[model samples]
Target: MATPNKENAPQHGTTGTAPLLLSRVAGNASAPEILIATMHGKEAVLAPALALLGFQVLLPVDYDTDALGTFSGDIRRPGTAFEAALEKARRACDATGVPRAVASEGSYRPSQSLFPGARNVELLAFVDRESGVEFVEYLTDVPTRFVKGRVPADPAAPETRALLAEIGWPAIRAMVVPNDPGEGVVLPEQVFKGIDHEAALAEAFRVCATHSDDGLVHLETDLRAHMNPTRMASVALVGTRLIERLRQEGYASAHPQFA
Candidate 1:
């Protein structure tokens, strides 16, 4: 999805201080607290946007984001990105007992237009329980870097090392899974912290190939915001869009007030 041209809509302005703005503008909307659920390390970028919009942002430590689906393509998530994001938001609402919450989900793969490369779609949803309204913002393109390759038998070979380097090795992690069919045994090794030695890649190769049909192990770019710079940047853009949607006063009239 491409980024939409943001026209200067009056309903989406945040100029005054938090307290002053809330008192004068958002008073009609119930719920003063907001929550953003993510395990993608998006907090660094998203928190500031919500703060500037006059909503207290909360992240419950117990939130299990993987339940929504992982980037490694394991445990296929149910429903579309919007459904998954809404599910995350509702869970946050349940955990914090807050009437307002936010959640985001991203999916990446080959572009429908252009085959066999990379394209990404990000969905950010704002749920106001008081208004029973869900305001969503989405973007495609997003400038992401994702790749897939077959693990080589000589994991320590120069060619294998070059592939890792291209994917931002230590900075971004990779997921190793069987390229065959059966049970998708995925072992996600955090190449970030320790062990740059080929031993790690060698071990990943052995595990995936053993279970695969063609004796091939698959590795792909981990799309987590913390791991992938491209994903983190996209989160920031989506957060800003969500904040703008939440700031709009007329959304209440657009949807029925719940509580």
Candidate 2:
């Protein structure tokens, strides 16, 4: 991925000073903590926003978020994005014995508008077990580098190279699997993810083609938060929205009394 332009990054809050929202919640002797359920370093993108509200972001160890769902279709997501996110948040609390947690879920689909690419829908769920309150924030039609199609197992071919360029290969990662698999069961060996270099991409196409019935590989951009910069940006955007919603609901003002 291209280096993120730090100078142009969005500012979540003032540096070194507590925000007004933080002051409202400062009655508590200890800062409130919210666990972020993720294995893809989502806390880095989300933590700053919640920190603005005086929330100390926590990450659970050995959290397996992929059990909830995976972008590569190996494991199907169980429900709507909101449900998935809520479950992840709830599970995080249960695992870490924390009363509050947050989780993010993203869905991508072909754009139905004038645009020809994909659209990403990002959702963030915050659950406060202490208050028995759960809320979700989402942003739809977010931009993404997601692309998918079948191609022959030849990385040097013009069509293959064109497809790679379209997905911004070497910067954005790729995932490959056989275009057609019997019984819709894809084995671990047949699936190659996080392919960034040309050599790895070539090898993935070769391996997937061997498994494909028609000798075609199904290639797509890796949508993991750590793999896709665009998706990370979307997560940050939605996280900011979540913090805004919390402020609007006066969660800090209301919950500080209990703290």
Please list the C-alpha lDDT of all candidates, in the order they appear: 0.61, 0.73
lDDT of 1: 0.61
Q: What is the C-alpha RMSD of each candidate to the true structure, in Å?
A: 10.4, 9.1
Question: Where's the lowest-lDDT run of ten residues in candidate 1?
Answer: 19-28
Query: 86-161, model 1: which lDDT tens digit per residue?
Result: 9988776655556777788887753455223436787888787777887678887776667667766457766666
CA displacement after TM-score superposition, residue 237 of candidate 1 (Å) = 1.5
lDDT for model 2 comes to: 0.73
User: What residue pairs are clashing in model 1?
Assistant: 1-140
RMSD of 2: 9.1
Error of 1 at 82 (Å): 1.6
lDDT tens digits by residue: candidate 2, 1-259:
2222334232223323531111111112256767778888787777766655666555554468898977766777786777899999987776655678889998785334522453668889989888898999987777767888888789888878888889888788888989532137677677788999888888898888888879778888888989888888888888888988888766553466323
**Model 2 / residue 182 / CA error / Å:** 15
For each candidate, give its TM-score against the true structure: 0.73, 0.81
